[model samples]
Target chain A: MTKDDLLIIDALQYVNWNRELFEQAREGGVDAIHVTIAYWENFAEVEANIAQWDRHFEECGDLVMPVRQAEDIDAARAAGKTGIILGFQNCSPVEDDLHNVERLHAMGVRIMQLSYNNQSLLATGCYEDDDAGITRFGREAIKEMNRVGMLIDMSHSAEKSTLQAIEYSQRPIAITHANPSSFHEALRNKSDTVLRALAESGGMLGVSLYPFHLRGGSDCKREDFCQMVYDAANLMGVERVGIGSDLCQNWGYETLEWMRSGKWTFRPDYGEGSAANADWPRQPDWFRDSRDFMNIAEGLRETGFSDEEVRKVMGLNWLEFFRDAFAPASSVGA
Target chain B: MTKDDLLIIDALQYVNWNRELFEQAREGGVDAIHVTIAYWENFAEVEANIAQWDRHFEECGDLVMPVRQAEDIDAARAAGKTGIILGFQNCSPVEDDLHNVERLHAMGVRIMQLSYNNQSLLATGCYEDDDAGITRFGREAIKEMNRVGMLIDMSHSAEKSTLQAIEYSQRPIAITHANPSSFHEALRNKSDTVLRALAESGGMLGVSLYPFHLRGGSDCKREDFCQMVYDAANLMGVERVGIGSDLCQNWGYETLEWMRSGKWTFRPDYGEGSAANADWPRQPDWFRDSRDFMNIAEGLRETGFSDEEVRKVMGLNWLEFFRDAFAPASSVGA
Candidate 1:
């Protein structure tokens, strides 16, 4: 197949989405992107966000379609339009109610993070001093998410919480966007132990391209990035590795501040980025936006990945993962 | 001391609060009542409820005063005004945020139930099929409640959840409006195991006078009610027992429906009352409104309780519990 013929998916992105961004995603030939519809927003607040997304779909129907099931991604590919798969970077959308899991899923949310960068009712975030692991509500939430066909994304969760979530969840979970700490020592990255456990539990890890998660931050070379992914694939099986750009496009510094602190604190919480660099970190030159997915595939090919392996890592893996992950347990029957 | 000299506290009441009800409380000589300010409300919704109460405070300043600290109960007793100590019948007001515990506390909410009449993130309510005990969110909520001096009330929660809450909580919890299941075997009532655990843990049990929870429903005799309290006091020390008089006054059938089923189901939830008697049950003739505290006190005296023992069960015990319960752990250091 030609480079243009392969499916492309980014498992995570929280962009200031508009028709322009939709057009850029189309230019990237992206089949689907799991866009965050929630962070610290509660159920009502998230519903308002969904209303805005509804408006986006209404206004930009020509360029993008909403992804309800995995097949919609294929339809988006067929239609030459990007599928917007709704997700949450935190469980705040459901708040304390497990019933909201099914509700939000009904509202087109297919992925959810148990915690953002703090201690939540479900699990501990990476920033917490103590990782209490998956909480009692967290256990119930996992079951509800499993039952309702929502993917559990532990991208920003603490290690113990993430591990416990993988163990407790009946269905395979996803670390939708984060790299291996072995490749880079950021607290947001997973350990080798987590990576191995995740793969063994039939989970997937979306290697992040966010600057802070990279070995050389904003200056990381594409060869180095491809090599890191290759090492992770060797460690976590090629089928379990894919791209989740963790891209935050068309957003100002205030959005970054909100992500870092939410309403959890009055003071600044310059998360992963330092106080001196208390803003959205710059993407490296090679992969600045949605248009740069080809560079990643080209770099992977140059790094000695066969075309089949390149397709799997680029989008096919996530497509397959979503195909299995986004069906209600009763409908799928295991 | 005369009966009027004794401090009178009703542990739980949810009146469609108005100047009339406040005047009735004055007539009943109720020094303080832990008023239900929330059932299934979310943070914003509960804030609206609080705002309404603020208006009440402004308009009916002659009839009532908001109780912030426990000593405010005494101030109300001294000033001849009923103190409104706000509480919740469910944890919905706090939703998923632990920080809201302190925020709600600042807004004058002092007691909160982990669940109302269905399974909540914190605990299983009385009406659920299975009792999962305290949830992960429940544990964290317990800690935050302890820290913030919010009384954890397990009134409508299932047995196992109640027992687990008492076990996990560092400070004492209250069953603010429940009777012993031994006295009358309703699902809403506490088991002997729960009673023993509660008393052993320095907790309090507010013997509910709600007709459905009472032995003979609306026909329940005042003597029988006092006898039940006397028996409870004998079984568990008198010091741990007090009146909760679950007086839900001045609301329509819709309010009862809201209490039984708050967006949890598309269908109706009759709660403790059956579909045949699905409407709010009538209060026993002897205890129709807040103006019936003397009847309870007199019945307790006639049920072989001495004046001191009557005072203890009527409100003195609750006064002591509130005195200890409403101060933050940092201030109380207990």
Candidate 2:
């Protein structure tokens, strides 16, 4: 791939890891991937998740390299390797103390979502009926994360908490995987106010292809996905927009059943005790039996975004945010 | 006193509570008092402070009645009882979680300081050299305070944190004890930007009688204090001007020494390390031992302000702000 090629960055992806997915990512021209290591796991559980990644690295070490800093992305590109930055979907791993954030930052867990889908001690989740914003503990968590230069992800936070978090986190935060509320007034879609605030706070909004939160809602086509990305870019300039595909490929009925249970689900609304619910098949039929991810790049090309805009939408924007947020803050005061 | 007679609320006071101070408050004809119950205390320690007050209520029950709601101020006035609303000079008691906020509010803690004199997880204290605005934690704390109807006080917060907090807080917070920086440029004084932001947030600026932060420092007369208040009124209308004397009349050298210590002092530069070391005996030599708080009323009259303006400067303004900030928020969404 050329330096000026559309270097897509899958800002978020929860897919089951396999050679097929890695091959698809390469075919799709995704330069880097911010992959999840923790969702509902606590300290030991999240540590175990990281340990599991040790095996993934051993098995697929040629396909991916752990990214602790922004420079690592460029290094990965030079080595022709897919840079994988470890991320978390919740702050439950750190529990409540401020010091744990430092420990996690050292572990290469670079990005963290403050809440999942309901109320935690730190903040309200996206699925919460009341969007009561960030809690005092959550505020403390943000400070700790900011201090250690961790990217704050707010994709699954309550509306009020998200806004407050955007303002509070001095460094840029990310949506990681969310669609525009203007496209579909679903709970998962962010409204224009949120998008505008995120941009103002020097943050980026990663448009997602979650299908469920899409305007078409499960019947979404690749063209529909491109349009959603374009819409976000149109509102916030292309420089501030990117993709967080949120693809959950390779999961079967039994796996889906486990994913739906509270024990497996980070949020309350998505699961129905077991992942085996028939409604779980609401994923669009077109995506089924698709063995490659190259279609995503072609879809963007069809959407008429320039090569540079496409690069940003892929992963460059996320990298820029990571570079700024991950830098250490000195004893600097105003 | 007539209902229409101006009633100035000593919005903040940390006097050594005794029969003398109570009699002084009554003699001063103070309508209501926002009394301190916590400073550098953990959860249990703060509870003890409140418990002490509970006993004080029993011992001198006829002198004062606790004011949980704004309307209670009126009840205290009508019943010929001194209104005592619980307040915190520092927000160290709520610990980390914001759920504790609701508990404190339930216990009648209506006002809280964002920071004392140095940095906490939330905001920087006024005495801190680095004024690095409000922390992510601080921002979240304010939102929770807004939700639970707690008034945010920034009398001892750093400058940038005060400015950012004023902008971020949904409700108008109170600078319960401070002077104008335009007059003295002291650490304890606030700048015009701080005042303007606070005013824009629909908040009140409680100009205090702390002489060290006044124009002439310890040399300021009662007229200088009135002029400073008038200048603030000129900047942020009469409706937003009120009084918050950072008064402490109960203790002597030992109190000052304690305040200067790290346990009580949030900022290292706040005091010279003891009441003995502090530029005592507070107020210039001319005003020393002047027992009459009514001099403030006379000073306001000297400013040639109308009775309405004087009424606001006394306590009406703070009362109005309390009503607005503590009210339930109805609107929700992007």
Candidate 3:
């Protein structure tokens, strides 16, 4: 497929929202983008975030449209606008009640990770000292999410918990943003064991282009990054891999602090980087912001991938995943 | 040691709290008993349960004393009273907050299962269609529980979750009440994999006397029960096995319903037994009430166990477990 005909879905991104960013995504020919709405906010705070997104949808109507279902991507594409899918990086918004899961699903929150950098109520985060896997509440929550057609994301979750979720969830889950530990030993990156399990279970791994998760950090070459994707595709089938450029743009140091040290702890936790450098890490020159997504596709083509394989990795895989994942449990196979 | 000299600790029992039950436990020469305080009640509701327990401790002071540490067992023995160790059969008492773990531990609650017969926030119950293992909240809760000296229990959790708990917990956990599935294939009975894992992790498996978990329900003979223990001892060393009894006395059919269907489910869930038999399952003639505990010791002695082994199966093993499991994390070894 040509770039215009191809479905281009960025499975995850948490960039500071503005008309500029939406225009950039539209300029990049991004058909659908899953946007992070909550990091560590509680129920009410998350509701406020949703309310804010509602305004953004209105203000940027010409540039972006809200995506509540897989078909919405096509709707956005037909309108010549980028589709925005809201997601949460942690389970905090659900609080202590499993009922909140269905409530959030109703409000257009399609994807929610079990945990962020630290442990949450659902599954262990990658930053925990020990990963106890999923909790009793987590099992119930997973069933509820699956039943309600909400996608379970485990990008920041620990290995055992990620594996258990892949096994336990009836529908396939997603690692919406993270690279493989084999390529880069970042704490947030996944292990080969988890990636293999995720692939075998028909789950998707959105290979992250976040600077901190890239080998050689912000200086990583486009060829090297594409080679990583090629290696991941060889390990996990090409259909199970996609792009989730976790590009955090136009956010200040305060946002970085908030992301790492949510109210869970009073002490500053400079996750993925040391405290010596306080600002957000530099973005790689090869992949910066939504506009650089096509660079990855071009790089993949150069790295021995066929045009079809490049298309799948660039966005088609995530579009297929969204088609299957964004439906009610009863309607998924049907 | 003689049966009289052995510290006869029943690792688990949930009886209708009355002076008669306390007297029966005392009559059985039980030194310490881990009593179920909460099943599915939330934090505030569990506090009400604890308040009720406070009254029980006040009224039954001569017959029972609250046990917060291993030293309390000896105190109860000296005073000729059974030490009551408050425990929860589910993690509901902690709700969604990790701080509640320390709060509950301070209130003298020691043993808390990650789930009941259904999924909880912490781990998957055996009744769940799929076991998601432990959740992110469960990981933080386990560490907090470990720090505060509360014991993790997994009697009603699924095999994967139970084994995960065994692997993840810093301190040894307990299967406070459940028999081996090898003895009887009840849904609640554990698999050999879990039993071996429990034993290898220096944990305790309190063999259940609940008829549903027995080989032939209420019709199971004393010799058969003893033989199952002997077989279990061969699989998991004798040091890891002890009596839990799971004795339920003077409870009506409604109580069974409450146990099976906690507040989490609106519909009645007839756990372990059918809805046709709503009342508590009939206990074997050899083991009916707290007073029937010694009968298990006699049965073990008859089934090729030496007197020392019988004492270990009856109570000594639990005493040793409590000795190591009830101290603050820092003081336990150092």
Candidate 4:
């Protein structure tokens, strides 16, 4: 399929949303995007974020539409709009209440990460000193999320928690956005063990384009990234791989601080033990914005991917994963 | 020192308080008691709990007084009242903010556990599948708690986290309510490694009296309990030993459910993995209430402890520990 004919879905992105950005996504032929709705927000704060997204849908109706089901992506594609799938980067939106899992799910949060870059009530994050696989509460939360169709995203979770979540969740889970650490040893990147377990469980991994996760950060070439994808596909079957493109577009330094520190500390916590990464690292020239997603498709094709493989990695795989992932456990026959 | 001459301090207890309970403690000759003020409560909820304690202090003025400093324990002794030392069984009251460590310390919360029975932002609890020692936030929290004179309590923390807290804190930490796991394989009990590390770091281990943490549960005899203490004293120096009791007086099964489940899960979570322990296990007949503390001292004497050693085990060691642990890190001189 030609690049234009391919259904492109940037599985995860937290851009400073506006009409310009939505138009930029459309300019890139992106059919759908999973937009992060919360990092450390509590239930009420998450509701505020959803309200903001509601306004975005109202005002940018021509460019974007809310996505609550797999069919919504098709609708967005037919309407030439970018479908917005609401996701949370932390379980804080549920606060201490497990029932809030279904409550948030009813409010259109289809994906919820068990933790961010720190330990949470649900599971250990990648930045914790040790990895506590999953808590008693996490087990119950996973079952509730699975029952209600809230996809478990473990992109920033520790290795053991990630693997356990994969095994424990009756339905397949997703990493949502992260690269393989074997390519570039970023703390946020997944290990080979985690990747294998993820693929074995029929899960999807949206390979990230975040500079810090890249082999050479911003200086990383498109060919290197595509090669990493090729390597990941070899490790985890091509069917379980997709372009998550953890693209953080148009956010400022303050936004990065908020992402890293949240309300957990009064001082700035530069996660991953790097004092040099205080500022947002530069994005690669090949994938600087939502509009640059096509470059990844081209790079994948150049890296020995067939047209079918390129189409699958670019978006089709995530589309299929989402179709199964977004349904309630009973209906999905998990 | 004779038993009557020694200042008796019960290091931990969560009782459904009333004037009668305060009178019972006074009758037990308890000079001070570290009362659990919060467990899984948020900041506002913790404040409400403090308000309730304030009412208890008002109504039971003849029997109890609030103890904010080590001197207050002596003051309670002089005044013939049981000094109430406020503590938290979980760090949930701090709720992801390091500043809350000092805030709650200023509010008379002298001792705070890094976690309850699950993973928290600060540390991993014993019930988790694995232990992720301390998080980056936990390190900073330890410093703040030390600076502010809030004793770091790791009674329910996982092994790695407990050891890390013992090593990381500028001041010695405390396992405020647990016994040696060698004596009883209960999940809440401490291991030899943890016990040795805690003693090597000049920390205190307040051996628990809760039946579940006892080897024989409710059937434990005074001789067996005293023998366990003697063994622990040999394992860890007698200077670092004391009584935390972990007494849960007058609470019903619903309170037990609240403790294990909290608000984190919709379904029941019988922590430490036994569904048969849904209700509070029966307290040992010899030490069923605060008034029974004299039995422990008598049992220790029977186990071949001298007057001084028995006095130290009963309360004097905890009194000295409180003198140092309740002081600011600078004042304690580490």
Candidate 5:
């Protein structure tokens, strides 16, 4: 396929969106984006978020289209618009009901994390003192999500919870934005065990390009990042690796704080951040925004990935995953 | 202890309250009883049920007292009143939050079934086509329940789910109302595997006197039941078996229909009932009401059980269990 034919999908991006950001994504040839629209919002709050996105689609329809199904991605590519697949970075939107999983899926929410950076109802977050795996509701929620076709995202879930989710979920789950802890020993990073099990379960790992997760922080060399991807692909097949970028662009420090704390604690929790550096970490120079995605593709080539493999890792892999992820379960007697 | 002084705690009883029922329990020398306060009710609905119980307690202050802990049974015994321990027959009261476990525990809900007669968020009921065991939320609910001191009742859960609950719970669970399937082959009855596991895990089996679960239906003889209890205690230790007379009193067939088909289906689901037999089954002649509890004690003696064994089966075993069931988990390094 030609460069134009290459389906470039970012598995995750939580940007404070505007026409300019949409234009940047369009310029970057981002066919679709799994955009995080909810973090710690309850059901009504998420509905309000969706209403705001409804306005975005109304005003910026030329730049972005809502992707409710896998075929919608193809439609967005054909129409030259970035397909926005709305997602939640935590289980709060579902509140305490598996019925909400179906409700949110109907509202065009295509993906959701079992936990963020704390102990959620469904699963333990990466920052919890104990990883209790998936809770009773989490299992039911996973089943409901699987039936209704919302991807289970384990990006910020604890290791035990994430691993259990990968095992328990009928459809393959997604680590929408995380790097391997073997490459960089960050608490947010996944282990080799999780990575391999993720691949074995036909799951995808959206390698984060956000500097906090990268080995060298904001100065992470493009070559080194690409090399890490190459090694990760070697551990987990190339068909499972893709860029999530974790692009948290144009959001204030307060927004980051909300993402971390979200009424869970009385005091501030820096999450993977420390008191010494308690703001959103700076992005790597190479992948500061959606427009710079091709830098990874070029670096992948430099790191000796084949053109077919580069195409697969960039977006084709996620496209394949989405085809399964968004289809309603084959109900036995429905 | 003398026969008059023996602690008599029935593990479960769901009687539509009246002064006569309390008087009958008092006549039977019953000290404490685990009374199901909710079944298939949501959080608010359960609160309403609790309010009704509060009114019952206010009106019948001379005959009944609420049991909030193991010690409350003794308090009721001293006051010559029947201790009413509040419990739920399903996890519906908790809705979808583990936080609710603590909240409900605070409200004096000491026991909850993970499921009833259909698929619950926590577990599959005995009547489901498939038993997928405990869900993700079930796991967390177990941990939270363990910490908050709620006795998990698996009386109506499916086989796999019951076994899993026995294995997964840190504290011992109770099959608060059911017989051994080896004795009757009823859908609600526990298997040899589940019974052995329950006993091994320090769990209790409140041998059900509900006719629907008995071997010979309403004609079930006192001797046959006492023999079954003896056999059951032989299988699952003597201390693990007690009476949980699932008495449905002071209600019409409409209440039975509600119990069997609570908004779960558009059509009537008879549950353990067949098409020809859709009303509530009659209790055995020996166990028609709380006043008949001594009939069981006498039958157990006829079945060659010692006075101490009868006392243990009647209440002391549950007393030993309650000592552990209602104490909030010791917080380490808090």
Candidate 6:
């Protein structure tokens, strides 16, 4: 498969979107990327994030193009440009408003997680002890999201809720950017039972490149990341598997610290109107120095994948999944 | 008994304090009252609440005096003044900072419920389903509150954390105002086990006059309110039973809807502000046609409580409980 056939679609990234990063994606052979703009934010905060993206579109139009249709992937690729598919690491920005899903969908958020790493109004986060599956609000959120034809991501969701969501959704769901817990046991990793159940519903499980899911946390080589995918493939077929690097290419350690605190900044009462405070947007330790996109591709190659398999794993699988999952605007249920 | 012997002390009331209320309390023989100046607010909001109290002190100095000690009650009675004990319906104003508790205590906030009717950073409110109990921050808050001699009220606390707090606190706590679950098995009502356990700490339970508690969800009269207290007295003995009327006097249905929506106003993100909007502060349905303080005393008299029993039930029992529970000025425990 040529570079064109191997459309490298990264399902997750939380970069500080500026002209430099947008230009970098164009150079990175990133055929398309799902950029996360929300985590632990409320609806207003998410709106601010979308507004920032609006500025990005106007400023960086030459390099970055927003993807509203699945067909836009080829248009972006043919134009030698990278398509930006907006995603959220958490549904917090929407908070208790299920109605905001359609509004956010209009603003270019195509994918949403039910929760972050703790209990939200909808679903319990993976970190919470009570994994009682989808809450009443969570079920409603799924219905709204399904109706809107937005992809439901269960990457950081509780196991029970993850399975419930895969079953509850009429359309195929996604465990976007996660590793099989059967390969490496971690709080963020998904179990085979859930992975298989997700696959059974024509859902997908995109293997994450986060080092924590590998054999060694931060010390992991790129081959470890590829092997995690092989393990998920062994349990669930290759068509149901994909690559979601969970890449925060330009972000750093300070980001994790901001994520850990319930408040993004010490003094930020609301995240609206500000691009977040200076205290927030701090780089976390993990992303202080990061592996570039080329290294990630080379790493997958070293893990015994053929060029055909690598093509699908890199981006083709996600492209096909997105086309199948998201219905046309007129066919949208909501 | 004389009006002085009645010694009526309202353990909790969040009324819009004005010269009229102060003059009314003086007329009704309210010796000392725990007036809530904070709820669903932050330090800045609490500061504003205190500022309003300062205005009240200036506007109605002849009839009102700040009550810092049990001695203040006696002093106010002799001085022919109504002693005002500042209180908080919720500790959200303090947010997650423990040091803020000291600032609030110094500002004359003597009583605080861990949360309103839902989860805050410190603890879960009664309306929240998960009973994870006192959070790490909540434990720290209790210790700080104990250190400052502020009364730790569990009137709206989750049962799991309430019991945990009862065991954790070095000082005795108060339910301040709540009904027994035996009377009304609602989330708002405490179970008989917690009620009995509260009295075991040499603590007190202030029976609320809210109709939701007395005879289940149905409306109740003054006699039904007396019967609920008698039931508590049967289980907890009369000494541990007192009145915490939760008199939201002059607070209207708009305020109730605000409280119900978890925002102070109908608009989005209406929280984070302490003062009710100028258009707010209308009287609710329960208080619109309710009897006065004399009517409550007469209701107890009609319910077979003797004049001597009336003195304890009205206020003396609460004062003695607070005197023993609250640490002296010098040796507040850490």
For this target, which candidate reaches the highest TM-score against the unseen true structure? Answer: 4
Which scores better on lDDT, 3 or 6? 3
Q: How high a TM-score does candidate 2 get?
A: 0.52
Interface RMSD of every predicted model, in angstroms: 7.8, 11.9, 5.7, 1.6, 8.8, 6.5
Model 6 chain B — which ten-residue stretch has the worst lDDT?
Answer: B264-273
Q: How much is B191 displaced in model 6, in angstroms?
A: 1.1
lDDT of 5 by residue, A268-329 (tens): 67777888999988888888898888888889988999999999999999998898888889
Model 1 lDDT tens row, B166-275: 99898999998899988899988988999999999989999998998999999999988899999999888999999899999989999998887665444576778878
For A226-331, candidate 3 gives per-residue lDDT tens digits of 9999999999999999988888888888898889876444456778888797678788887777787778888898999999998888888988888889899888
All candidates' chain B TM-scores are 0.98, 0.90, 0.97, 0.97, 0.97, 0.87
* lDDT, candidate 1, at A122: 74
- What lDDT score goes with residue B52 in model 4? 97
Of candidate 4 chain B, the 10-residue stretch with the lowest lDDT total is B270-279
**A192-246: candidate 6 lDDT, tens digit per residue:** 8898898888888877766555556556655666677766776887788886767
Please report, as a value between 0 and 1, the fraction of native contacts recovered by candidate 3.
Answer: 0.05
Which is superior by TM-score, 2 or 4? 4
lDDT of 2 by residue, A99-136 (tens): 67889999879899987664454666666444445654
DockQ of each: 0.08, 0.02, 0.08, 0.62, 0.06, 0.09
CAPRI-style grade of the A/B interface in model 3: incorrect
Between candidates 1 and 2, name the one with more favorable DockQ: 1
User: Can you tell me the CAPRI class of model 2?
Assistant: incorrect
Model 4 spans with C-alpha error above 4 angstroms: A1-4, A265-267, B1-4, B272-277
Reference-based TM-score, model 4: 0.94
The predictions' CA RMSDs to the true structure, in order, are 6.6, 11.3, 6.5, 2.4, 6.8, 7.2
Best-matching candidate per DockQ: 4
lDDT (tens digit, per residue) of candidate 1 on A1-334: 4548679999998899887888888888888999998888888889999999899989999999999999999998988899999999998877655688888999999999998877666777787655657765577788889998999999999898889989999999999999999889998999999999999999999989999999999999999999999999999999999999999999989888888767645457788887788888889999999998999999999998899999999999999999989988998897
